[model samples]
Target: MIHITLPDGSRKPFEDQPTGLAVAKSISEGLARECVAMEVDGQLVDLNRTIENDAAVRLITTRDPEALEIMRHSAAHVMAQAVMHVYPDAKLTIGPVVEDGFYYDIDMQPLSEEAFPEIEAEMKRIVKAKIPVERHEVSKANALEFYKNEPYKTEMISELADGTISFYKQGDFTDLCRGPHVPHTGFVRAFKLMRVSGAYWRADQSKAQLQRIYGTAFFDKKQLKAHLEFIEEAKKRNHRKIGTAMDLFSFHDDAPGMAFFHPKGMAVWNALLDFWREAHREAGYVETKTPIILKRALWEKSGHWENYRENMYTTEVDDEAYAIKPMNCPGGMLLFGTRPHSYRELPLRVAEIGLVHRHEMSGVLNGLFRVRSFHQDDAHLYMMADQIQSEILDLLRLEEKMYSQFGLDFHLELSTRPEKSIGTDEQWEVATEGLRAALDAYGRDYLINEGDGAFYGPKIDLHIKDALGRTWQCGTIQLDMSLPERFDLTYVGKDNEKHRPIMLHRTVFGSIERFLGVLIEHFAGKFPLWLAPVQAVLLPINDDLIPFAEKVASTMIQAGLRVEVDDRTESLNRKVREAQLAKTPLILTCGGKEKEAGTVSVRTLDGSVHYGIPMQQFMQQVTAHVAERRLELDLFEK
Candidate 1:
């Protein structure tokens, strides 16, 4: 008899080797009908797979998070099958599930978004057929022979180890995959073909370019519809659109990945920098400026020449090769080496808002988010080994405070050393442990991502979620031991001997440009009072009130507010609408009644208004709001 242990610690004894379906049926017919897949011994597998030995099993239903991944995987296969049905000449490469959807790269006739409707219809038909998905294990030789006609599949087979490979078949369509797919195509009840794009095979530019079809799936139609609505909302909050609408920033073809900040955009940028500087000062950090270009020898010593050369841009200066700085750490290293340090100066925090450039593929160039040139709010802390935990905790606290100021919610991820990292095993272990201890002390949950750290050290990454529920990686705290060794940085200890200092490389805002992009979407271009380019705009009802509007604007300007007066010939409604479109935090209207009463009517961005407010009272309330940096406008009484 084999004992199958369920997740709830219940066990069932089977007389013989039984499948997951049999076990489920023993529990209840309803459970058996609902289970899409099973986890046996913590490994996901088809329900038809027999469990011969005693093991733990968990049934995955539509409600389980993993179930969505399984269903989406099956949906991808169904999509491929439909594509093959419609275009028999199409050659499939690979289809894999991403964050919220799946994509299949194929070599076929040029496909466009216009073709999604027909492709989706075909997929729907296949789903209606409820084709059973069968899994088969075959020898590598047989797998090669089965896919001999498909070059991509054959290439994949040749690269695999000499062992058994898995393949899944659905009706007439079969593909090479190690899948724990849904039981049948019918399980993919709600799906949509999102769009078509171009992708190079294996993501190598020199390789064959293929058409990639992107699609999403859900367990039910309601979830699918909700996701579609979320996508539409995201489009409306897209930073590129909002930036153009607000006249914040723009990009040009001549300077591919650089942003040209307009006057209004600079106001927001300067405010953020001022806030950063004040916070850094309070946190015991001294700001520094470094050159934009440095000698190649510096990069080589820092390991960038060996590990990050592909992303770096180099220039020949006076016959010597110099690199346009892709990262600020190397420059920080050189700065530290410039002055001999003593242990008394331990935990020396040096900050730099330095510009950096990296070569990004043209196809991947996004607005400010994926720019080739950007500024990093970087800081390097040189501390004694014993001070590691405390320094890291301080950095974490600063990160939380900064994000909180922006009203952004963030999660932490601890990334360990990567395969290509430069450090002794013992050094990496100590560095990683220091970060882990700090996180534990903070009493917050964090995810561990193995083999995903910087080339020189382990790091804790902060991923912040915007209003629309999109996550962006912004802050990072990297603990490094290699840079000091590479640069021969040392401080005189109490023993009268020189000892290496441990370096903490960190950035609260990973890239200023990217953070701005995130902020644009997070606030939907409706900035808070303090951050708004124009805190308030005075709109006169007619030309008669223009002088009163100007007087109010001058008063506001004297009170250190960024205020503007709309004295143009436009009608009262037109000027008010324009101010709303501009997303000004406050709109104050002055007309005959308000002018005679020495009062102003306050209108907020959300269309709430308060009439006949005394000028001094209104100024006091707005000044207090801006001083407090309140994210929401609660100053006006409605």
Candidate 2:
């Protein structure tokens, strides 16, 4: 008999070699029906795989996060089969699931729109066939022979060590994979063929370009529909579109990956900088700035000249080589070395809103997220060993304050030292303990991710949750002993001897440009009063009321408020509509009645109209909204 431990901490003895499906059926029919895959003794396996020894079991279904991944993997296989049916000669490469969908790379030429219908039709046929996907284990030699004609697959097999490989088969189609896929091909109900493009086999420019078909899928029809609708909505809110609509920013071909912030965009930029400066000052952080170009020897000493030379842009000054700064740390290190310090002046926190540049692949160049030039909210702390815990605690506290203000909920993950780390065991022990105690002091829950740290140190990452429920890694705190040792950064101890200082590198908003894009998407282009480029717009009902509207705009602007005037010959309703479309928070209209009564008609983004409020009263309401950065600002001004 074999004892199987279930997820609920209960054990059941099976008299013979029973499959995971058999165990599930014994427990509950509902669970058995939903169960798609299982794990035995920490190894994920197919439900049909027989379990003969004592082990731990976990059944994964559509309800599990990992199940979505498995289902999408099977969906990719169905898509591959569909493609093969349409173009019998098309050679398959890789079809893997990502984020919310799957993409398949095939070695085909010049695929166009005319191909989608035939491929989709073939997909329907495969779905109707309800083909059972059988998984088989094959030796490495067998796999290479089976895919001898398929160069990509053959290359993959050649790279594999001497071991058994898993292959999935549906109908006459089979592909090499390691998977615990869904039950059958018929399970792909909600699927969509999004787009097609060309991609290099391994993203290497020298490699042959392959045809890539991108698609998305969901478990149910409604969810898929909603997903498509959500995508459409996101397109509407895309910064590329909204930036032009609001006259915020633009991108030029000459400076492909650089953004040109217009006047309105400058207002938003200043707003962020103002808030950042205020927070850093209150958090005991001293701000510093560094030059954009530095000597090549500096980068060489930082180890980036060797490892990151490909990404760093080089130039020459007076026949000597210099490199454009790709990072701010080396400059910060130079500053730390400029002055000798003592233990009494320890825990020195230096911050920089430094601009950096790098050569990113053209394929991966996104709006503001993956730009060639951007600013980092970077900080580096030089402290004694005893101050490590308190420094991390301070950084976390500041991170919480900044993120909460942006309506971002964050989770912490403590990444342990990697296999090839630079620190001694004693140093790692002290640093790890410091981080653990800091986490405990805040009473926050965090999971240990083994071997995910940087090459030089251990760290903690804060994943910020967006409105779409997606987590973006935006904050990090890394402890480094190697850099200090390399730079010979020292502080005098109480015994008058020099001791190496521990360096803690941290960033709250990892990239200012990316954070700005996130803010745009999170707020859905309807920025709060404080962050809005034009917080208020003054609208006059007619030509006669133009003077009063301008007066009100001027007054608001003088009071440190961002306000604009729309005194065009357009109708009152048209002006209001334009302001609403621009996503401005508040609009004050000056009609004859409002002008005569020393009042204004206030309107909001939500289309609420409030009539006859004194200008002072309306300003009070606006100030309150701006002060709180309210999610739902009151339209009423009385």
C-alpha-based local distance difference test score of model 1: 0.92
> What clash pairs does model 1 have?
none
Quote the positional error of residue 338 for candidate 2 in Å: 1.1
Q: Per-candidate RMSD vs. true structure? A: 1.6, 2.3
**lDDT by residue for model 2 over 268-311, one digit each (tens)?**
88888888888899988899999989999988877778767888
TM-score of each: 0.97, 0.94
Best by TM-score: 1
Using alpha carbons, what is the TM-score of model 2?
A: 0.94
lDDT of 1 by residue, 321-412 (tens): 99999999988988999988999999999999999999999879899889999999999999999999999999999999999998999999
Output the worst ten-in-a-row residue range by lDDT, candidate 1: 629-638
The lDDT of each candidate is 0.92, 0.85
